[model samples]
Structure formats: C-alpha cells, structure tokens
Target chain A: MSKKVKIVAATGCPTGIAHTFMAEEALKRAAEKLGVEIKVETHGQVGVQNQLTKEEIRAADGVIVAADKDVDAGRFKGKPTVDVSVSAGIKEAEHLIQQIIDGKARPYKGNSNAESKQEESSEGKSAGGFGRAIYKHLMNGVSHMLPFVVGGGVLIALSFLFGIHSANPDHESYNEFAAFLNSTGGVAFGLMVPILAAFIGQSIAQRPGMVAGFVGGMMANTGGAGFLGGIVAGFIAGYIILLLMKLLKGLPRTLDGLKAIFLYPLFGIFLTGAAMYFVVEPMTTINEAMMSFLSNFQDANPILLGLIVGSMSALDMGGPVNKAAYLTGTALLSDGNFFFMAGVSAACITPPLITAFATVFFRKFFNEQERNAGLVNFILGSTHITEGAIPFAAKNPIVVIPILMVGSSISAILTYIFSVQVPAPHGGFLVLPVVTNGVLWVVAILIGSLVGGFIYGMYQKYSYQKTK
Target chain B: MELLNKNLIKMHTNFQTQEEVFEGIASLAVEQGLASDKKTVVAGLANREKESTTGFFDGFAIPHTKNSAIQKAGIVIMVNESGLEWNSMDGQPAKFFISLLIPENEAGTTHLTLLAAVSRMLVHEDIRAKLLTLENEEKIYEEIKRFLSENM
Candidate 1:
C-alpha cells in the first residue's frame, strides 16, 4: 500500500468566538479517530496560538481550512486544502478529515487560463450581482469618508457651539480652537470625494482609472449629488478611462509610459467629470426628485407612513430600502419632527433585537456559537448598530427577513403612537434626553423591540427544531 | 495505483436510493473485471464508512478502505442524478461519491494525486456542473479525463 499519510487542520469562524475553538476541537478528534497524526494551528482573536511551523506544512500530506472570513492562504499556497465554511468543520469534522485522507480537497490555482475560464462560466457579471462588488468598492470609499465626516461634522457642530454671528463686525470672536478645527475639517472634507472616486475607479479599471474616477466623484459631490452620486461618478470615471484606453490602443509603443501616467489620467478625469456634469447630474436630479416626492408624507396618515418606512427599512438590512427610511428620518431632524426621529430610532435597533431574540427563544435554528453571537448583537443593536444581524441574515434569510420586518414595524408603530422624538442622528440610552418624551420614548422602544425580538426568536426556535 | 488513470468511472441512473448506491457501483466494478465479486467490495466500503463518516464539508464523500478483497486498485466515481444523503458535513446530504480502491501495495502516490485533483475541482461550481452532465459511464470517463487534463 502507498505509505500511510497524515494531515492536520485548523478551523475557525469569524468573531473568534466559541465556534473557532469548537471547530479546532472537532478536527483534532476526527484526526485521532482516523488513526492519523495531525497538528492544527489556530489563529484567533485571543491571538495566534498553536501555529503550524514551516516544517509542519512541508511535511504534511494535506491541509483543511474551514473559515468564514478571509484568511491569509499564502502560507499554504501549494498545499492541498479543502476550503469550507466554519459550520461544516464543526458539524462534519470527521467527514472533512476523511475526505482529506482520500484526497478530495486542495487550494485554489491562480493561473490566468483557469481564472478566465472561471470568469466565463460565471457569466461576466450579472446585473444584480454587481451589488456586492459595488459594495466592496464603496466600503473603501466609506472607510476613507468616515475620517472626513467625523472631523468636518464635529467642527461644524462646534461652529454652532462657539462661533459668533455678530450684528456688529467688532463683536465676533475668532476662536483659535474653532478655526483650527474648522480648517482641518475643511481639508478633510475636500479629500472625501476625490478619495472615493479614486478607489472606485481602481476597483473598476485598476490604477489607470484613479484620476478620472476621483474627478468624477468630486464633480458629483460639488454638483449637489450625494453618496449615491459618488457611486455613479466612480463608475463613470472608471468606464470612461477604459474607453479612452481602448480608443488609443493603436498608439505607438514608445508613448505607452506617458499614456499611462499623464494622457490617460488627465483626459480620463476631464472627460468623465464633464460628461457626469452635463449628463448624469440632470438624471440624478430627477431621481432625487422622485425619492423626495415619495419621502413627502408631511400631513399624510402617520400609521401608513410608519408601516412603509419600517417595512422598507428592514427589507434588506442597510440596502437602498433601509437607507431610504433612514434618510427620511434624518430629513425630519431639520424640521424638528420628533415623530419621524422616534420611528427611525425604533427601526434602527429592531434587526439586532430580533436576532438576539431568535437565539434566546429559538435556540434550535442557530448553533451554540450563533446563540452566543446573538447576545453580543443585542448590546450592539441597542447602540444602533443594526448591521450586527447581517451574518445571520445572510445565512438564513427566509427566517431573518420576516422577523426583522415584524420587529421593525412594531417598533415604528409604537414610536408614532407615543409621539417619541430624537434630536440626534443615532445612539441609544446615552442620547435619549435629546428625544421628546424621553422616558416614555425609551419605554415604548424597549417594549416594542422586545416583543419583536421575542416573537422572532420563538419562531426561529420552532423552525430549527422541526428541521432537526 | 491500478486505477491511476481516469478509466474506473461507473455511472448509472438505477442507483436511485441510498440503499442501492453500493450495489450499482459494485456491479460496474465487476463488469469491468476490476473486482470479481460486487457484494464483497460493497461490504468492504460500507464497513469502512461505518468506522467513520466519509462526508466532507464541501458536500463530498470519499468512501474508501484498505481492504485487500479487490483484485486491482481502482477508483470508481458514482454521480447520483438526484442528490441523496451521505451524512455531509454541512448537514446537507451529499450528491457526489468518489469510491476509491487502493491496492494493498499501491504504486507510487497516484491515489494521492488523483484525490487532490478531485478535491480541488469540487470547489469550482463549473467543474461540478460539468461532472453532473455525465449521463453514462462513457461520458463520465470522458468528462473526468477532460477536466483532469485541463484543470490538473
């Protein structure tokens, strides 16, 4: 017989919670039962422990990596690995080990031919599929945008706090702290559009699209376009640069370098910005008008508005629908409409609350680790981080969707009934006083959110048990 | 090592239920003269699986054993037209079964090489789909060979 081979593996879920260690344990038990000598390397939040050395990887027959997040696969590039989601490792550890022993797993091959073949089979990017790709690109822009927003917003708030508006020119105070804060904030704000554009362009057409994309994003921002416009401008900049490159493909080889740095970027930025200004702006204005018209329910029925906003807010959990409801609430902040603010506040925490309730009431639908994560999600939800429910939602959308919707709706209705109000954009218990009828508002949200969460949790539990 | 090349594929639609998976696969093995008795080989594979589940996380089963009951070392790939339960890792039932028969003294590391190839391709949804199109034994052999030659 061929020499008996052995393999070791490390398995983990994101959050470095119990599942990470549980998967590790499962792999170890499976390997031992299979009569193979295996070593596992676990890298977790507590830090990398029991790491596999170079000698171990070189000597090993194969590797099994069941992870949820992006783990650096570079270490075991040439090694045979079975990439699986972390739950698989926990639930089917032995099978995974056996499969490895039988040779059913390996690392991804990165050759050009395979990549092109993969791309072709994937249908060259479907329409709705672009959401995730766009989201990734937008995340880079958002990450960069945050620093500017925080600095600029804080400075603007301070301008309200300390800056003087004098009837007489002599009475105004030029505060150094405010000036410095405002100036730095302005610089940060100036870079926001450019940085957003550059990254999006990079995502679309690589480095060549950066200049054009930046210019387009800036134009969109300056032309009264918002975050949505930045996204459009980014795409415009990237594709426009690509078109330019295609048109100039026949250029002499000697001018390639110059074309890359100067000609491509300069012309790309100018053309894309000019096109977006003349073409995209009018379209964007129309789109905004539609959105605003839809958002205009000033004297309309409160209950109907609450239901629409709440349901849409929970539909996709931070998607366009969710953003629509949120923006509507923020707009009301300007009008001192506390009812809208209350509705938004209630909607914001419902997702996480429902998720947490699922874990508590319907323990069967979720694994042990998910239940643990749910607890953390509860605290996060109250703090207005509705995104905490994303993982669970992605995993079990059918159940999560209805649960969140019901929960958000209940919260929204309660907010409207109580005539609750919040002055600030977001925050929970800490910022409660800025809200109208602070005590009653908090009570309504707590009771409504709890009811929603409890119902979802119970339903999830029943469904989970039935499946098992 | 005897089944080192992509020649030991056994595809049939009659293996509808989990109970008949071993029977259908063993029947093909006997017809090819890879093994004389279908029952013996099936029993051996079942016994090995009883010791531990053959399921993998990515929805795969590599049911195999070191039993010397077979005449030649061979790998028999059986694709179920409809997905069935093989007690998979993700708690989803497995749809594909790669039954490998390594000789008592297998030649070189051919078994390891072939296993690695199959496992690597399982991750590719395209390759998996192409494998599912094999309606008969000949098609199975042809598709697997083409995939290996192009992919491996």
Candidate 2:
C-alpha cells in the first residue's frame, strides 16, 4: 500500500470557547474516518494545546487553519493550505480535507515576520457569504462591549439605591461610597464604545485594524453619536486600514516595517478621524432626531408609542431590531428621558418569561430538551435577557415570535400608560428601586407574560395537532 | 488491517433498492466472518436507518451500526453506477454505499471516528467522481485503501 497521507491543522476563536475545541474534534473525527494520519493544535482560553512540531509541518501533505483571530501561517510557506472560519472547521472539515487531497489548496506565500504584509491577502477567505461576514464582525464587537455595559450599568444602578442625588458631587446628599461606584461605573461605560470599535476593526483587518478602530470609536463618543456611531466608526476604521494595506503592497522590502508602524496608523487615524468628523457627525443629528421623535410620542398617545417600541424590542429577540429599540432607549437616557427606557425594559423581560410560562402550561407542545431550555429562560428573562427566547422562536418562529411580540407590546403599553420611568439603561427586576413606578412595571410585565403565554400555548396545541 | 479487501467490496452493483443493497452487504459480511447473525445485524442497521437516513448530498450513503452480532469492526462497500433512490437531506440519490459493522462495546469513539472519516471522504465532489469511474472490485478496493491512507 502507498504511504499514509498526513495532515496538520490549527483552531482558535476570539473567546477561546466551545467553537475552538469543537472544530478540533471535528477535524480529528473526519481524519480518522478518511484513514488519514492527522494532528490538531488548538489555541483555546487555557492557551495552546498539542502544538505542532516543525517536523510534522514539513512532512504534512497540507495544512488547515480554522480560526477567528489571526493565526501565524508562516511555518507552512511551501505547503498547500486551506484557511477557513472556526464554524467551517466544524461544518465542512471533510470538504477542506478533500481539497488538500485533490491538490486544490493554495500554497502559503505570506511572510510571517513582516507586520506590514497585507494581512488580508495571506489570510484564508471566510467560508460564509458577505452577510454572514458582516454579522460575525458586528457580533465580535458587541460581545466584547457587553461586559463593560453590564458592569457599568449595574454599578450605576447600585449607586442609585443610596438615593439618586448621592452620586451628584455638587449635591449635599452626595455619599462617598455612591460617588465611588458612580465614577468607576462611568469609567467602564467610557470604555464601551472604544472597545466595540477596536474589536470590530480587529475582526476585519486583524491587529492593525484595532488602533484606527479605537480612535474612530472615541471620536464617535466625543461627537455624541453613541452606539450607532460606534458601529459605523468600527467598519470605517477596519475597511480604511484594509484599503491602505492593499494600496501599499508595492512598497520595497526594506521599507515594509515603515508601512505598518508609520504609514497605516497615521493615514488610518487621519482618514477615520475625517470620516468621523464629516460623515459620522451627521449620525448624531439623526440619533437626536430619533430621540426627539420618541420624545414627541409623549404627546401623541402613550399606548400607541408603547405598542410600537414594545413590539420592536421583541421582534427578533435580541437581534438587530431588538438592539435598535434598546439603543434608542439608552441614547434617550443620556437625554434625560427615562420613560421610553421603562417601556423598553418591560418589553425585553416579557418574551422569555412568556416562553417559560408556555412550556409549563403547554408541555405537550415542546420536547424534553426544549422544556428544560424553557425552564432556564425564567432566570434569563428575569435578568432582562431576551435572547433566552431565541431557541423557542428558532424552533417554531411562525407561532412563537408573534406571541412574544404581542405580549411584549402589551407590557410596553401598560408601562407607558402608567408613566413609569427607569433612569438606568439595564437591569431587570434587580434595579426596581430606581424605577419611578416599580409596582406598575411588575404588574405590566406579569399581565403581558400571562396573556402571551396563554396565546402561545393554545396556538401550539391547536396548530401542531392539526398538522399532525 | 485488510478490513476492506475484495471480499468486503462489490463494484458496479445492480441492486435497485436500498433494502436489497443493505441485505447484500450484510450477507457478504457474514460470509466473510466479519459479522455473526446476519438477521440481527440487518435489523439493527434498519433500526438505525429509521432514526435517520445515512444518505448524504454527494450521491453516497453510509449506513453504519454497532451490534452484538458484529464480531469485528469492519466496512463493506458497494458501488451502484446507475444510482438508486435515497431519502437524502439534499435530495440526491446515492450511488456509493458504505455500510459499517462494529462490536457493540467498541462503538464509542473509534466507531464514530471511522464513520466520520468515511462520510467526509465521500462528500467531496472530486472523490465521488473518481469513485464512480472505477469498474472492477480490485480497483475499487485499491481506491478505498488509497483514500483511507493518503487523502484524509
């Protein structure tokens, strides 16, 4: 028999979470069945494991690198290599292996030591479509930004427990402990935009994209453009750096070092700053216009305004639409309009709670695994995590999403009609003391959850049975 | 391991139905002493199929099982040049059949790995195209061996 085909692979992700190990396992499993000898190196949160030796790299037929972050591909310069996203490693390991086997993979020609080499050119193309790439980059930024928002929002809420004036340094009621909490929380919140832009840039242009991205984010903050502006700035910074890299490809080898350190950042920061000033400045106006429109709703029937905002919050269950509603509310919070956020919070908390209630009331509609997931939604919903409803909606979107939207809308309407105002941007029942009308907010949430759950249960029972 | 030799493979098989193809491979395994109790093995495979179809998008099916009747972990491959009806997820009929038999206790990691390997290999268009051209049993076995050893 001929000699065995040998292959080496690497896997990594931004969070070093489940995807990294999952891809490694998938590659190993695929290799075994194909009767190919293979070794996998995983770069996880705990650090690198099963490091590939130089001998193994030289002897391998090909290399496969599945990573979300930048992975050094210089070691396999002469070898055929296929680079793909971590998800592709899990879903299409066999296809990738076959590409190597068929001699369809490209040779790695990237200079690993050169920081100025256009990182995009040497990198493997993303396996997903354009839409998927955009979504992935956006999520990368959002995931990194969440800790700052949550920590800061919670601390600020805690400070309010000592009396709202306790955080104001000029107020006679100012307490030292409350001031400390407020200041620390303010610092975390201050980092939120910059971190979001930096990661988004990192996702697009690798390490070099981060500097311009952070600068753009800071500009957005200074410009008063908020979250929406941060997103635009991130994309701008990433693409600008990517464009500069491509443009500077013909530079002399001796000057390669200058392109990354001197040229890219200098031009990147200048262009991104210009874009933030000229282009992104207009977004702040749009944001102000949106906030004003929401504020004007106070005069145009509270119930209708509540219905619109509430339904939007639950529309995608923490997806783009939901984030848009929450963003509007948060932006308005800085404008000193807390009533809109009160409606948003109420809407956000109802979907998962309603789903949990449905699972208990209509157990026959859900499978064992789904019922267990439903139970966990109680905690998630109580914490204002609308994403807890995603699993249920994904399974039967036709029935579940409409129910959630309607229920959340009812909650928002009730909260608005009661004139409830929430000063903080986040925190479910945990920040009840800070709400202007806490008891009514609870009443609205419960009513909405019960109505929504009852509707969902009945629909599942009747519709599913008919289909069967 | 000569687990996949001439005895475990049939080229240009004429079976018109999945059931006929499965039964043919099961009997061959029993005849080759790779498995015991052909009836039990066939039934176990059918039960596994009931849970989920093994048919993949690239015109191949891998129906595998671990059963008490399987005395060893082995694979039986059959090629149907004309292709046969299969309820594949991608709605493609299966042309290459790779059926596996493993001892019940050995069906954990090793069995799954082997199954994954075979499934992934057959999913590739180039490999599937190459597989369809080889007409003789020896050539088919050689191809399988080469694929298992070299192009994983």
Candidate 3:
C-alpha cells in the first residue's frame, strides 16, 4: 500500500481544555479533507494523550504546533512546521493543512536538544488500518448512493404497479401519474453513479477530487461501464488529483488563488477524464462479463441455483448459512437484480408449506400437537418465515430436513424456469401483487409441497404403523 | 466530569467590563465547587489572559485557566446583553463568556475530553449563533451539554 503523507501536531491551551481540543479537531478535519495522515498530541486538563513517538517525528514530512501554552516544540527542528496560536489552528486549519500539503512551510529553525526531555509517552495506537480506511471510503460512497437508489427504485417499482410498460406512453395501462413517477425516478436514478464517485472522491481528496470524480463517473456511465466502473473512476479521480497537486507544488505563492479556482480543477478534471477514458474501456468488458454471469442465474441453470439456495435455507433453518444466502440475495436486489431473491424467497416459502401440506395429507399419522403446529405453519409459510419448518426438522432432522430441502429446491427451480420476478425482497405471498406471474409462483410452490408432502406423510404413516 | 450545568449558566447578565466578567466567572466557579476561592480563579484567568487574549470571533470569549485553586474541571457560561471591552482577535467587544477552570492535579482525569469538546465547538458559526439566540440559561446549558456528549 502507498503510505499516506504524515504530519505531527501538538496542541495546548493554558486551561488545557477547550482550545487544545478545538485545534486538534480542526487540524484532523483539515488533514482528512486533504487526504493526509496526521497524529495530534493534546495537552489538556487530563494531561497529554501522546501517541507521538521519535520514529513518527522522524518520519513526518511536516509538523504543526498549535498552542497557547508551551508544548515544547524544540524537538521538531529541521522539519517543515506551521507554528500558530491555538485559535489560528482552529480558524485557519485548512490553510495550514494546505500549506503542509504544498510543502511550502519553512523548516522550523530550532535546536534539537534531546536532553530537554519532552516526555516521550506513546500508547493507544489507532487501529484504523489501511483496509478499514478503504472500507470507510467505500462506505462513504455506498451510504450516499443508497438514498438515490431507494428513492428512484421505489418510484420506478410503483410505476410497475400501473404496468411495467406504463412509462412507454403508448401502452394501454399507461397512467399520467405512473409515467411521471417513472421518468422522475429514472432521472434521480441516473445520478447514482456520479454521486457514488463524487462522495468517494470527497472521502479520498476533498473538493478538487470531488470535481474530478463527478466528471469521471459521468464518463464511466456514458461509456456503459456501470457502477463498478464508477467505483474505479472515483479512486482514479482522487489519486489523479492528489498527483496533480503534488506536481504543481513548485508554482509561486502569488498564483495560489488562481491555482485553487482555475488551474487545479481544470487540469484535474481533464486528466481524470482522460484517465477514465482508458479505464472505462477495459472496465466495460469486465462489467459486461459480470452482468452476463449474474443474468445467467436468471436466464439459465435455475436448478443449480435452486439446489444451493434450497439446501442452505434448510440447513439449520434461520442460522448463519441461511442468513448468508438471504443477505446475498438482498445485496443483489440492491444492485437491481431481483431474480436471485425471487428464487431465495421461493425456497424459503417451500419448507414450511410442505410441513403444512403433510399434516393434512396424512391426518391419521399426526398427533393433535403436530396437527396444531402444522396449521400454524400455513400462516408462517405464507409470510415467508422459513424458521417455522425448524420444529418439524428438529423432530427428525436427519430425515425431515432432506425432504424440506427437496421441496424448497423444486419450488425455487420452478419459479426461476417460469420467469417469476419478485420486485420486493420480502412479504412472501403478501408481495404477490407486485410479483410478476404471481399465481404461477404460488402454483410452483404448491406443486413442490404436494410432491414432498406425499413422501413425508407416507414415511410418517409407515413409522406410526410399525410403532403400533 | 459533568462540564457545564444550569447553575453555571447565567443568561442576560449586564456585565460592562472584562475585569467584572472575570470576577463573575471566578465566583460562579467557586460556587460550583470547581475552585477553592474566587481570588485564585480570577488570578489564573487574568494571568492566562495576559499571555494572550482568549476573546474569539463575533463577541465570544473563552477565558480559561488551570491553577492549584481549582478542585475540578468545569465551565461557567455568561451571556451578557452589554458588551465588555476585550482585546479580541476580531477587535469586537465581547458579550458571551464561556469560562473554563481546570485543577492543577487533573492529569489523566476524563475532564479534558469535555473541555476540549467545548474549546472545539467555538469554531462552528451555527452553534455560536444559536447560543446568542437562546432565551434561558437551562436551555443554553442543555445545548452545550448535548453538543459535548455527542462529540466526546
């Protein structure tokens, strides 16, 4: 991993409370905005929380001492330093961060006296490692993108209530409200890629990076590279802007104002746009391949997906394995792929419904307790609660779970083959109104249950006869 | 430590000078059991002020100090209707005072986090604007406390 540019800061106020912390927060915010690494030592009422070490001081490219009280800065000699009042640290934090980034600050002209012994205390090393940092940046993008997705997706889904083709205007089911919702939703949805890229860029390199990220993301979208490409564009834009800033650091101080408003953004966007053009080409191919693979789970090989989903749903029903499959389906649903979730929902609905069917089919084989529980499963199955099947499985898990798996598999496979598209993630049969081929989906579930119910009922009858 | 409270917050006071403001803050700190006496608190605040003015932007001053006289870390907020003569960074007469007192032996106590949170809060324009608009001392104390809890 590329190491971040590190800066060391010391903050203190006479009372050692308000100003010290304010300056630290201000510096940290500024450094984060600029995508630089910083370690701040605070001299406060509770004393110093110094994780700053000799190695850190030696490694840091710049030093910032923002204090009203003496923090003993003589140790930072020969390092480029910004020496300022605690108030200035808070008020002019960004400027100081910018100065550090530009490497424009003069080296502190102080003697290094190791003998003076500024307390070398180090502990509580922050665990914000590189992987977590990257995740944080990605989360910043993901979080902002979700709002647009929900707003657009729900409105679009509502348009489907009028009919899937209602937005086409010439369609018979077209209504004015549906058409309006569809188009408005489409417009908002179109911004998802740009917003994702822009926020990621903001996380990586603040304002200039955001500009580049937006433009790059637009290019990625127009190129048909999709959301993954948008992510690539964001990182590229952020890094490119950082690279640009470094390259232009040699410019005269008089041109600083012009560089900010005119030069940096113009050059930054142009470079990121040019870079994304090359990036999007390869990404388009990768994106197309991934999309095809995903759609294949819908268009072909329903049985393979069915077995996997069905088995996982039945294996320790409502356990981690089941949750894993459910989460995967939900994640894909968020990506606007509903087929996996459709199969997953079918699989989950099957096991409980099978047990309900078994009780009715072999009424003589079941006790009163079993009959009552089976009746409850009817309601649970309809609501897509797979855990309702657990009681029956727990009775004879070795035998019963396999039967449940087979029933779930058949339901999932049939749903996929029949092209039943469930727009909503949950609500089971309750979401049937929004589901395409809704009745066929129920028929598919019923067929699986009927077959599995017969086998399960026969087994119970045989066991009951043997016991008698 | 619980940094600020209703007793420490006095709204719409008509202080006319910086010295009187310091005296008022010292008395409040003494009453709150944060400081041993008013004189040491006033002296600490004055001595720190002589080093550099704590007067900040838009008629707000955060006068703070640490001394042997203080028994704890605490804050006193005084919102005066009349402005006092303070050699502030903005050259504006100060009307709002957020005073801080820290005991000399308060090292490693958790009060620093609370104090630092208050110190950092002064930079936000919205909070500063809201502070001047608040009508009651309890509301002001609550607002500051709420902000501190969120930050700390």
Which should have the higher TM-score, number 1 or number 2? Answer: 2
Between candidates 2 and 3, which one is better according to TM-score? Answer: 2
Using TM-score as the measure, what is the rank order of every candidate, best first? 2, 3, 1
State which candidate has the highest TM-score. Answer: 2
Candidates in order: C-alpha RMSD to true structure: 18.3, 13.0, 20.6
Model number 2 iRMSD: 10.1
Q: What TM value does chain B of candidate 2 have?
A: 0.87
Per-residue lDDT of candidate 1, residues A379-409 (tens digit): 6576565655654554445666776777787
Itemize residue pairs with steric clashes in candidate 2. Answer: A33-B117, A34-B117
lDDT of 2 by residue, B9-95 (tens): 887778887778878888989999988888888887777665446666567777777689888778898887677766664567887
Score chain B of each candidate by TM-score. 0.73, 0.87, 0.95
In candidate 3, position A41 carries an lDDT of 94
The iRMS of model 1 comes to: 12.2
- Model 3 steric clash pairs: A18-B119, A22-B120
Q: Summing lDDT over every window of 10 consecutive residues in candidate 1 chain A, give the lowest-scoring window.
A: A109-118
DockQ of 3: 0.28
Index of the highest-lDDT prediction: 3
Query: What's the TM-score of each model vs. the native?
Result: 0.40, 0.51, 0.41
A best-first ranking of the candidates according to their lDDT comes to 3, 2, 1
Q: Give the TM-score of chain A, superposed on the true chain A, for all candidates in the order listed.
A: 0.47, 0.62, 0.47
